[model samples]
Target: MTAAPTHASLDPSGFESRHFGIDDIFYSRTDGRGIILAANAVFQRVSVYDWSDLIGAPHNVIRHPDMPRGVFHLMWSILGDGKPFCGYIKNKAEDGSHYWVLAVACPLEDGFLSVRIKPGTEMFRQAQQIYTDLRHRERNENLPPEASSDALLQAFESAGYSDYASFMTKALTEETKHRDIALQRPADWRLRSILSIKEGVKEIEDHAGDVVRIFKQTNQIPYNMRLQAGRLEGTDGPISVISNNHRQMTQSLADAVATFSEKSLLGNDYLIQAEFLHGVSRVQHDLLQSFGLEPVIDGQDKAQEKALLSRQQMEFVSMAHKAVVEVSDRVSAFSKICNDVRRLKAGLEMTRVMCKIERSRIAERVDGLDEIVQQLGKAQTDLDHLLSKMDGAVQQILEAAERLTQSRQRAA
Candidate 1:
């Protein structure tokens, strides 16, 4: 039988220098206008560039040819804005060998401060392969350079999605599962679960606010257009062009609802979710215009409780934010509980399997206490679903916020 791999086995530290692992630091250099000044031994070993050869070359020289141009383009964009940036990068060595690095690069007094850790996890490795393939395809098509992060997302939708939100939802779900998902019991699982659900809903609401901010900041496609054209030719058109793609609207309301369900299961407070939500809603609003489906906020009710509802919603948002901060404080506590529960269940399952393996078919009735464990799993699933529903409802509130913003803008 194959043995379970140890953490050390899964992660190699051979790249460490005499003092630290190779992954401890990939490179430590100062560059002048993207040209390298000095590099560490580990950097030379992994990048396959000799100290002499790397000292004068552009940083892009080590950028893997297969890596997506969009990422580098984004990095440059950040630098132009005088902002530090970080991302997962795949760099090629002098010998054509590839390595993955979780890299952070930022401008310094003279040049830049760059730090990287070698990452060989399956998630990053697979992403590297995917990026490489995408790059190759771009080369063959002779299309502009490559898609912008947003445009790449649009490409996913253009292949078939009503908006970027649906695409991002699907992508995030896939990414989460690829990374590995685990659940646990709560000391106050029920209460914490409820709080978590509220937080998830609030996160959706917050994302809406962010989307509005982004739209306000960059409504003109001209700037992004120039970036897209310079890199990904032919994709510099208005948002209308991509939003109107027939394939983009293939995703239905039902699909969006399901995405909310899956995403709400783990946690919330996504950094990019507002962007995704804004993108999706934009598509939906555009489609409604095209198809002549009257867009409605569904707020026609004139009950006296309207004021109360508004106040309650605001209170909920505030309370949810507080809960989110608390959850962050005790982050991973719930997951640890889940890990304990999972381990216990696995132990029980092993006993049952061993019995079958040995042909000892006597089922030991541990029902007296075993029932509780089973109940916990069911509770976990139910909590997950509840969190999901809350997320959807909260997302609706975000939609309302968006509408409110648009209305105010029009009035102004």
Candidate 2:
């Protein structure tokens, strides 16, 4: 590995770069280990490097010194696994000029494809400051790239990013939003839907946490009934049998609820994966719409480039569509779960009805018997209320995923 560049070595005093318009997008395709394979005209223009110097060259030929080694370490770690990565990157030109871009890197069959836009958002400034601080720390503490990468993630957590996945998606979404405003363009609905899906999935995950508590509360009804049964009559009486049956049914229902919670969590992961690919497709689609249509020396090269770019974008889009469908199926599973829970709720209602009947039949008075029946009534009421809300949320998610799926199909 190249020795980590020190802050002094990467000082901005030497930065001399050309500014590209916010509309300008830089594109490059590189091999697995960062060897450059192809590039767009804008990238060639900004880097001040010809096709001869860029093609087959290590991508680091343009890597800005001011960029902390930690960023690249984190970047390659994700990209190495054929995953997509989005972050702000500063690149150096052949004559040492520098320009910053919000870059999205996606893994390709042969290597990786990067699409970058000039960042107009305030987040770009934040990224610059973060990189400077990390580079300074690396120089002062003799930190390795991996250690500096850990520090960078800690810095992100301090800045309100829960993890790298959330941070990357939010950052890309922010940059895209700012770009639209800067260009005086309408909002990109594609990217907006991706964020909305992510938020919806998070809501589902939060609600899943309550399943255990809700199911556990119902267990108390049987226990309370059994206690009262012992006082009202000898053990193994009619009330005792009813309580035992309630326990068995509720136990099975509890197991089903547990599975629902697990599926909710798994669905949340699918949302993240879908959002990541959607973001990938968004940037590549931009390039396809603008870059491929522009003039190139030979129209054939442009066609070929657009074809490959479209293929990659569609590949992600296809996977994202599948994920959205999977999320929909998970929602359907939740519907079934809610139905199962409803059956248990019905059972509780019946048990309460039986208790009331028994109270009327008894000539001798029993203390707290009415209250236990009321408690059973309350549990059923709560379960009904919870199921209604959960079903509503599930419906909303299903509708949102359907819309998102339709958009993906159109984009494909």
Give all TM-scores, in the order shown.
0.36, 0.85
Q: What's the residue-level lDDT of 119 in candidate 2?
A: 81
Clashing pairs in 2: 16-97
- Candidate 1 error regions (>4 Å): 1-23, 146-151, 155-412
Cand. 2 TM to true fold: 0.85
- C-alpha lDDT score of every prediction, in listed order: 0.42, 0.78
For residues 319-355, write the lDDT of model 2, one tens digit per residue: 8778878878877876776666667678888888888
What lDDT does candidate 1 reach at residue 188?
Answer: 26
* Best of the candidates, TM-score: 2
Count of steric clashes across candidates, in order = 11, 1
Task: List CA RMSD, all candidates.
Answer: 27.4, 4.6
lDDT of 1: 0.42
